[model samples]
Target: MDNNSILLIDPTFDPASASTCNLLVKVGLDSFSYAIINKETKQVNAVFDEQECDNGAQKFAERLKTDSYLKLPYQEVKFAIHTANTIAIPNDLYNEANLESHSQFFTESHSGNLYCQAQNHFGFTTIFTLLRAIDKTLEEFTYAKKYEQNAGLIQLAEKLDGYNLLLDFTVASFNVLFIKNQQVVFQQCYEIENTEEFNYYILLIINQLNINLQETALNLTGIINKGDEKYHCLLKYFSKADFISVDTDLNQEVLDDMPAHYYSSLLALNQCV
Candidate 1:
């Protein structure tokens, strides 16, 4: 599927899941939006958002299904139970030593595919020019660069192998694959948060596993409140750790048009490939 791509849309309207393992759909409950990328023209054929309709997805789909923008034959569509973001955890049992362990948390499910959601928030035809920039590179990061340097504060600082960490404060989710000698040794889900109990949960994993923090790279994908100073402060404690924000960049015009929820979906979509 070179010219065309298959996307598993997770259109979640409900906000129930809140752990690391459970599937989540809604990134920003109030922010609903959608977009149409024309692979042929390499532009956003159309865009829409929530304000357009009391119910966004159904309305947008009805309109597009009728007109068939791009005319590429809307191939397939299905709603999935999107998974929560994961993080590598550390042990808190040995407070003095700060040991680590492995465990997962999750969040609730959302409703509706984000594309249609985008349309609901922004006008369907407003961003036609910008959507053409929808290339894979724009959506993913093999290594973190475009993301703010502050986002990498943890990665720039930490060295933890066999230690566990939890992410509780975030609104997203991810999977942590532990690689040793260039091979996947283990994989687990982690939820990084600001709660003391969650922090202890991470330490519990470290202490119980009896692993050293000298050699570990924690991989994560999910929605992070970069605007929150609290998250930055907590990150300061994780010196010797590496962190990356995995998400796509909507052209400035698109960003201005879409709702808040689209950000995480974009991040999740970037990593999905």
Candidate 2:
């Protein structure tokens, strides 16, 4: 109902499910999930499982194009991807963070190796902000592969800095530099197991990067949703800048059936058109 906020859709299926577009949306702090049953009917709406959908951020974004009715007028779609047992941050931080209006989508690059690209409301940028939120100094900031790289994610990161900075500092697992003095300077990616860990990492980045909170902006977004506690932590930690979430927009008619969550990947075929 809020014009300033964007629509979020999370599909947890294999992407090859029925033509019906199934997605979930967060109503508010309560995290009420809603589904699009049909493009015309708009019926059969109900609360569903938050984790039922297996579709990751990339796969979920692709689903928006095909969904019969997920596309609401002001809904901007985006997604997040992560491996199992890999905790980026908590949900409380995400919920309490004072966020701005501008947001973007980062997907595993379609082109090359472990790179990523940022997609904001404007257009695609050419800078890839790798998710390396580990301990690193400026002297050790060489572009090295710290963990086993994901080919899908690598290509996406490589193309993040070629475009204009719609707002300011890019937010991913780590605080990123979209453009610096006409050149793309990749910053360290922050990592943490929970909210406390996230705070430690965030502070570490601020201290090491010589970041001025008053001057620069704090833009943060998370891909995982373990619970409201973690979300609340993120909201409180970065309570200055804007906070936004990535979701899917599905056609209304497709959702009436209320299909299972595992059909997300199979549903993306509609985007090929």
TM per candidate: 0.34, 0.30
lDDT of each: 0.29, 0.30
lDDT of 2: 0.30
Best by TM-score: 1
- What local lDDT score does residue 184 receive in model 1, on the 0 to 100 scale? 28
Please list the residue runs of candidate 2 whose C-alpha ends up more than 4 Å from where it truly belongs after superposition: 1-184, 187-191, 223-241, 245-273
Tens-digit per-residue lDDT, 151-244, candidate 2:
1122223333343111111112322343333333333333334567766665565577565444454333323332444445544544444332
* Tens-digit per-residue lDDT, 115-189, candidate 1: 211111111110001011221312321221121101121221123334344231223223333434332233334
Number of clashing pairs, model 1?
A: 89
RMSD of 1: 17.5
Name the regions of candidate 1 deviating beyond 4 angstroms: 1-38, 41-73, 76-177, 186-194, 208-212, 218-220, 226-237, 240-253, 256-273
Report per-prediction Cα RMSD to one decimal.
17.5, 16.2
